[model samples]
Target chain A: MSHKIGFEGYKHENNVGFFGKENSKDGKDGKEGKDDICPVATQVHHLIELY
Target chain B: MILVLGQCSDQVIGAFMHHCVKHSVDFAFVDLNQLGKSIDMDELYWFFPGQSPVSHSDITGVYNRFLDWPKQNKYQMDRLLSLFDWLDHRYENVINRPKDTMSNLSKPYQLDIASQFFSWSIPKTNIIMNTQIKIKSPFICKSISSERSIVNQVYRQEEKAFYEPALLQAYIPGLNIRVHACDDVIVAVGIQSDAVDYRYSRFENDIFMYHLPGQVEKDILALNRTLGLRFSGVDLIYHNKKYYFLEANPSPGYAYFESQLSRPYISEALVSSLSRSIH
Candidate 1:
């Protein structure tokens, strides 16, 4: 077995309840989370926008 | 009035909206998700979901976090292009103009800019395509572009060769400090983690406020100014009494750091700066 670096292998599993996801206490995908800080709401291609 | 540009799903946009409402700041949310649906725009005015059409002249500042339009139609594509051009050329307080954010698209280019600042030292980096260039023993692989990729340590010789161009740099071991600068406010946070990429670390990492040296903080603000970025999140590694510049995230997903802090320092600074044109 190969060692996973960072979130390499665990990304899929950890996506459900990552560090920022904890804000979504109501479990509505951050709809009612504290201050509405939902991690999932961010775009996948966050920084870059391909022209 | 502040013009907020982003999709309805974006949390940073949500957080900014919350701040505006809480502070009694007048603003309009232009959800890009509704670009062609509920929203319509002529050359001079914008029609939001539920409000009177607003003239471009009325907007004093813009908080633009548009990653991409939700749909890709003829109208959407043209509007996206026009909007991007406007964001790039607009004189109003744009947190970060699109062209300024283009620096992050190329890590090598960004590193070159960082190298200009005295407080930052860049790791020996090589962007290789088909050719093999050797760096010191302990090196890590990173994405050449702004696209996210987990930083991986190269243990084997085979890993050094890249079929596609990638950034290979001498790994600097130390604390990860993220510096967020909005206009004049700079908030620095340190992350203590064992994983190569602390952002995706499986183990819990300690997040706390970090105070940068006065000169280093000044240099960071200068770098932001040089890049023409009103807002940015700079990544730095402090190792052996030196700080290594990683990269600056123009459209930083700051909600993560703000969640850990007692107050949303970055967001607050950002919102305050965006609303500054009013008072």
Candidate 2:
């Protein structure tokens, strides 16, 4: 399953809930969790338009 | 360091930030709503909840996707504007600088600019004020402001009321093509829809990655360069073996296409481009 977040449900006060997926599991430091390294990142085309 | 300025709910900015995190790249995001509260500007401080404060000098390149200023008290807004102005002068690799982005707010102005390019053409357009005006039928009406989408069939009536003149253009029936360009990198998609405005029927529309003719690609690049935009989403129509330019969007919303269509968009390209510029 591909995990995705949408603009409709995002809240500024709770950005960690959106970006801090790793921290959510372990209750680790948000900053450190944010910097967790994943060498193989998804790379796609530079443009994406629906219509 | 890369800085993203926009709404926290903005999925496009969120995705780009994710890419940066996965690659272990230095980046920071400032929600416009947190301007005077969480993000203070005595000298530049970023107070991400639970994270240590960061300074502005740490940032090098900024990906500015801030569409509108926050509706805060006048003093706070002025302070935020001053901070933005300072950043504008400090950073050299800011994508879609404020001035360049502001120029594209008007749809008519952008269409006029796109018309000047050789690879694109525009539909016969006019600002209709009176019902007495005569024009071909099946024309589409659009709002001059980008805030609204008023694409509707032209109906003949007496005493039409418009606070501002509405745009009327000869409706060209053809494939809708959207081209997104970031510097030399460009991606074009063809949209097939039954509705006049494909955006209204997004789920029903069919999307396919398009390969643009070399000349068309060059022309788009030229248009981007001419407008001094590092990234832009351009709308066009393919009719009668010709392309009709629509408008240029300085801050395009690509999250829908990225998630639904599974296309690698500005996410990876933006990181690499910003990283390259910094190095």
Candidate 3:
């Protein structure tokens, strides 16, 4: 009931899709959707490791 | 053939399909959400209007309207992007390959590059990972990767309300607005949201309007060029009469605004732009 359009809720409305955190199997202490806010960083690191 | 991703019946998807048909262009629809299993690449090589993926290799171009890719498997996302990359490289003659369309869809990357000019209003946002969600008493938190509507929450004066790691920002008291920034023209919708929540105002009765500032128009356009975003739906918040930059949607749902306003301004503009790009 208190749900709000995150974009409208916060100023970063476009970031709605990128905020989801899929934590690793480490559970609660594991990662959240770190890629949500900045997937570019992870993507870059992934790409470099690929090379 | 141009492939319009997503389901065919959806209004916006249908519009894109209809536009291709009206222009007598070759196109196919790839329902990634409907795609069943670990299929081979050949299954979706070519898209036939009024038809599903086929074994044919004559697929010349693609409109690249695949939004559901992110939701699909990494292979799914790569498969769709790969097709576009191939189409652009192999048959540039078949696909639009227009700069405007590309920029329009990459709103995030575009905004990243355009932030320099609009740094004042835009939030001091950082794309961080694993950094425990930091809050400043009454702060804002949202998942940047969310897809649903109104599922994002705003914490009010709570230190550890949800305890979930999310986007934390300094909550600003202002007007929330979405600006329809196509390649040529820019239009915006303003909402008077509760100084704190406002994001959830969709369910609550609130004041909203369509507005444009004389000064911001030029800068928005310039920022568009800087970001290489041909067409984008950007969120702009106005607090104390000064505008602030929120975010941008490269492939926004124009239908929502058009239906809510009972007008097809943005939708029609998008259709027209797509047609011109193909021609």
Candidate 4:
């Protein structure tokens, strides 16, 4: 066996943020707190290997 | 009700949703990828923004089962991190709150926490941001605040990475031990192989799975209480039968347990555990 152990693909699960146009959850806060609104985290992370 | 952030249309999540439905628990999901568009660019707060001010406490918990990153793309990174913090505030009063998925997810934290109560020794590690020269051979460079960043580049030298700040840590040579801790119990431990950095590589054929020894289990379970986390994926590197701490993937991927090793029993275990809340 490769003996490559522990933290594998699934274990690295995280919350990658987004950087695009908005969708749902864009609420009255957008219309109400116009000056207070800002961007949200949506970028996803993946392994980029170099062989 | 639990709030999930990802593809409302995913398999693992879908399965989890089924559980919620079966038990009549409330849940919410927001595709941050899609939700990003309408999001404002300057208002979200980063780091600790104090306690969240969500008026409604309807949401009793949160499950962050998504693949995300940090420390890159100035325009988006801060915003995403802010979201987590925001949710932390929003869901702060929930029964099961989530810790910072990034920055806090590292092998060193796991080892450190595990060492407090367990008789285990993880490999030496370094979490540095400077890409400057001054690194020893066989060290893993990971982002303290990002997921499996395709951008994470490990090196024997610090020169190449110093230009831009990245996480650098010493490498541990040992059997990989992925232990799942829920409710302060070592629920699962499996072994694998074949990739230098499994986080960024794909070699399933070479990977194998095994149960942890009993004595080791005792030590692991004892350490679980220290984390104060309802869920934790503990990844450790083992050398000479001794475990060297790597990082604790807080919001680990459950799909691997089911998809790769066919440990679908995890779903049942989760269902059974979460069922406690249902009653």
Candidate 5:
């Protein structure tokens, strides 16, 4: 089964806003804003394979 | 002139502004987050803070990218509503008016329209809200409305009754495909992710350009036209050598897909369309 463990417990739920600007909700710096990664600070189980 | 409406921090709006500058397209940006106390609205003119009042005749088109209403004073909210009302009732050449985009609020309604185009397949789905009905195992549950929610598989053993209404859909195992149509231009990208909802996937999604069949592309364009949208992002599942239509996003965040491509096809198409004078 390709289930992502603890997906409900993650920090970012809505996957809101892509760009970051001054006083933006997503991030303070544009660097962090553009960076798309898992919000949680731990490794996750990987499943599914597509080419 | 083209009027771009929404917050400056939104990537889609930012991309439109960037393209406008790069392409020398005459345009104006109304940052919704920066609205001050009030805006003076008359039949033909609107006066925002720190700028001369703009005549309605001066705008040929409007690119609306409003996500959610930011926390605003009562005066700002009233002014925003006034603007929204005018844009819906009196405007032409709006990429999409708010009212026209209402179909997206109901996923089943959108799917009903998608069902018209026979080229693509739609998964077996149902909206369960305070009703008794038989359902199969290995199904997924998601938000019935356009409200963002992560797609999660429903275990048969869990409580069958949902506290809140949700859409239960048969889980079709396959690769995910996102097709973005900007007016007549459509771009397809295949997403390979292990996560049920690719948006929240922890692993990096393998996004690659997918060349869709000629008829499929045409039908998608037709579907967009039927939905009264000049731009949309459609979700599909490629299963058993057939494409299954999931849902259509009227206000698509195309920046993520555009970032992966060598050229910004979606944004460029939008800019080109918005740049043209309505007259």
Candidate 6:
């Protein structure tokens, strides 16, 4: 059985607005606003072996 | 009544519609593209066509999977935006509120929110112009939005000619794990692909189901809560015995997994969750 372990978290440099300006105030700086709504995220997961 | 908002041909919505039929649930699908053609909205009325015109009060819950905007004249587009804005504000039991989706319009934005609660680290990412920047080789580049292709290597001769801003991440080698969480239920799968972008791989037949460890499951739930998403598909890479965080997808295509794995109960879980929200 594979066990999970927590890794040391690293602080990312705040690179807000590195991309162009978001069209709305909510999408600005990649910050969550009170209004921005998204649906549930689902996808197919595929893995490839490197060895 | 449940309203499913998405493209007419989306397989995910097709699966959801299948489940609704199996249970004899009353549901309707409103094609995202066709909305602008016939949607009639006034302070006193809301109209969308399916089998018949559906009114605002008739809808109890919404499962929104809309992705692309349809081609329309500028006046039509403006009108559709206004109508969408009204629906975004009026609906409360939607699978995802439209406003929240707007905030997560880009991968970097989603990563910023995921970093707040995830136990793992995200790759060092920079969104830069096609102009050369000093970065290690073997990094991956993708569009900030889902509208573009994902390419490996920071400096691809083909992509270098295109002058557009793109997101570049330090590539990590490891196994890919995708976790689908709906409400409190979590289903995880391991994917094995030979291509750098697994979605484009020809060896899709190699994909298989996977189980996640207990701690990792807990972290995923927390991450979903932080994003205010009750349903999500989370991507993680297990590298060097540690998991690295990838972006969280709001509208994930689950038909691939549904066809591959039997244990996750993807469509059933979604139906049950949505059903509960109605009552």
DockQ of each: 0.04, 0.03, 0.03, 0.03, 0.03, 0.03
The 10 consecutive residues of candidate 1 chain B with the worst lDDT sum are B152-161
Q: Residue A47 deviation, candidate 4, in Å?
A: 38
Highest DockQ among the candidates is held by which one? Answer: 1
lDDT of 5 by residue, B64-95 (tens): 86666768889887677777776677776787
What's the TM for chain B in candidate 6? 0.83
| lDDT (CA) per prediction | 0.71, 0.65, 0.47, 0.47, 0.70, 0.61
Q: Kindly report the docking quality category of candidate 3.
A: incorrect
Stretches > 4 Å off in candidate 6: A1-51, B36-55, B73-79, B152-163
For model 6, the DockQ equals: 0.03
Decide which is better by DockQ, 2 or 5. Answer: 2
TM-score winner: 1
lDDT of 4 by residue, B1-279 (tens): 455554432334544554445455554444455344432223422111222322223434456555444234665655666666655665443212345443244445555666675556655555555445666686766654433443234567554444444556666655666776655445454555455655333434233555777876666555544554555566666777676665555555544444344444555555445434431
Q: Could you estimate the TM-score for every candidate?
A: 0.81, 0.78, 0.59, 0.57, 0.79, 0.72
Per-residue accuracy of model 6 over B116-219 as CA lDDT, tens digit each? 76468888887887575554366777777655454534443333332587787778888887777877888877777786666655444355677777878898
- Cα lDDT tens digits, model 3, B128-245, are 4554444555555555442322324555645443343344555666677777776677767766555454433334324344767666777777766665555666667777867777
**Candidate 6 global CA lDDT score:** 0.61
Residue B164, model 3, lDDT = 37
lDDT of 6 by residue, A1-51 (tens): 211000000001122221112212232212211111233233345885658
**Each prediction's RMSD to truth:** 9.6, 11.2, 11.5, 14.0, 12.7, 15.6
Q: Which CAPRI tier for candidate 5?
A: incorrect
Interface RMSD per candidate:
15.0, 13.5, 15.1, 17.1, 15.3, 18.1
Q: Summarize candidate 2's per-residue lDDT along B1-279 as a digit string, tens digits.
A: 677777654556766666665667777677778777766655666556556666666666678876556679987776676766765576667876776776555667877888887876889887755445544366777876555463645543423444467777778889998887877888788889877776654245687888888999998888888888887777889999999998877776654344434546656667666656554
Cα TM-score of candidate 3 = 0.59
Score chain A of model 1 by TM-score against the reference chain A.
0.21
